[model samples]
Target chain A: AQRVTQPEKLLSVFKGAPVELKCNYSYSGSPELFWYVQYSRQRLQLLLRHISRESIKGFTADLNKGETSFHLKKPFAQEEDSAMYYCALDIQGAQKLVFGQGTRLTINP
Target chain B: EAGVTQSPTHLIKTRGQQATLRCSPISGHTSVYWYQQALGLGLQFLLWYDEGEERNRGNFPPRFSGRQFPNYSSELNVNALELEDSALYLCASSLAKRVRGQPQHFGDGTRLSIL
Candidate 1:
């Protein structure tokens, strides 16, 4: 069975602190991972994908096949960065997304 | 261009009743997907439709079914709704060109509350 896991349900950090939102997955085939963010009163939107390897909003996630992880990280946390973040896995050729439970990050000023 | 759209921003129904949710894909997009976002459960894939065909479905019961029209718009019908069936149903669309890792555009979603 394919599954995505975000171990932290809630994470808090002071402004300017480093932030890391962990995500792990279980799949038998090569995986395509993505990070999605949903801010208050806003629709869910794509944050970044591992394949793109580009940073979005100063956040970067590296897909580590050996560890089965794609943890999202940022050098400095900002108040605006607070939101519900979900880690998703795209089943190749299936056009489906398996999502994790999501982690709500709170940046306290 | 307009993005994907979903109807009836909110819907309310009682147990054992049926609920119908609608979605319209972005122009030129032939693939439509449905997902359920329940509290604490996160998002779960429900169904996928492309070009008037049911491409694939997630691990859900037959009571949770849907279809795509020739216009690429779709409707999801939930029969015998239960209390646990309450959720925010989301619709997404993408080009059906078999492109590897194509990103999907999402709608605001319909919040269905089962009474």
Candidate 2:
């Protein structure tokens, strides 16, 4: 079975500090990874996908097949970036996605 | 273009009762997906419908069922609801089956409370 693991339940960082939300997956085939974010009082929205290879809002994630990890990172965290981040993995042959427990990131002023 | 829309922002029901949640995908979108976000379970896939057909379903029991209409709107019906069934049900939509890289746009979700 395909599974996604997000080790951190909450991460707090000061503004301008670097942020990294860990994510790991267990799948046999080529996996499609995505990072979704939900801000306060807002609906969940897609932040970026591994397939795109383009950064969105200063966030970027690289697919590491060897380590089975797709960690989301940003060089400088902003107060507005505080939100809940979810890592998802789309397994082979399954059109649906398996999501991690999500990490609530709080950027302190 | 408008994003995905779901009906009844909040729903309250008692045990053994039935709860029906509705979702209308964005204009021209043919795929709709249902997910349950419980307190601790995160988001779990419940159902997927496209072109008025049930394409996939999660590990949820048969009590959790849904259907898509000709206009690409969908409804999720939960039978014999239990207290554990209380959660935020989210609805998302995409272009179609062939749009591999398209992200799923989501709605504000319906917060269901089972008494």
Candidate 3:
């Protein structure tokens, strides 16, 4: 069974501070990871994917197969970065996503 | 292009009743996926349809079923709904081709309340 776990249910940080949303997964096979974010009134959108290895919106996540973790990180947080962040794992080639409990990120002004 | 769209932004039903949620994928997309966003469960994949066929489904009961139309739109039918069934249902779409690893685009979701 593939599982995604986001340890923090809520994370708060001041603007310009570094942000790291922790994510851990339990999967026996090779994994594909993705970070999805949902703003106040916006739909859930893709933030970044490990397969692409490209950063989006100043956020990046590296797949650590040894540790089974794919933590989303940003050098400096912004007020507009406040949103609900979800870490998802793709189940092999099935295109199914197993999501974490999600971390609500709040950047204070 | 328009993003994935879900109909009936909000739905209210009583226990034992049935709830049907609709999803229209983005244009040119051939795959549609359904997910349930309960209070604490986060997002659980419910169903996946491609090319008018049910490709995959989550651990949900048989009461949770859905189908994709020829046009690539989809409908999720929940039978004999229970209070625990109340949650926000989200729809997403992506290209069926697996080579590209296309990201799934999501909709605003429909809030279903079971009384």
- lDDT per residue for candidate 1 within B26-85, as digits (tens), equals 999999999999997889999999989999999889999999999999999999999999
Q: How well is candidate 3 docked (DockQ)?
A: 0.70
Q: How high is each candidate's TM-score?
A: 0.97, 0.98, 0.97
lDDT of each: 0.94, 0.92, 0.93
lDDT of 1 at B28: 95
> For residues B1-115, what per-residue lDDT tens digits would candidate 2 score against the true structure?
8889998999999999999999999998899999999998899999889899998999899999999999999999999999999999999998888355567889999999999
Q: After superposing candidate 2, which stretches have Cα over 4 Å from the reference?
A: none
Q: Candidate 1 - CAPRI tier?
A: medium
- Score candidate 1 by DockQ: 0.70
- Candidate 3 contains a number of clashing pairs equal to 0
- Predicted complex 3: CAPRI docking category: medium
Model 3, A1-109: lDDT tens per residue?
Answer: 6899999999999999999999999999888889999999999999998999999999999999999999999999999999999999888767888899999999999
Better of 1 and 3 by lDDT: 1
Better of 1 and 3 by DockQ: 1
Candidate 1 chain B lowest-lDDT run of ten: B97-106
- TM-score (0 to 1) of chain B, per candidate? 0.97, 0.97, 0.97
Q: Clashing residue pairs in candidate 2, if any?
A: none
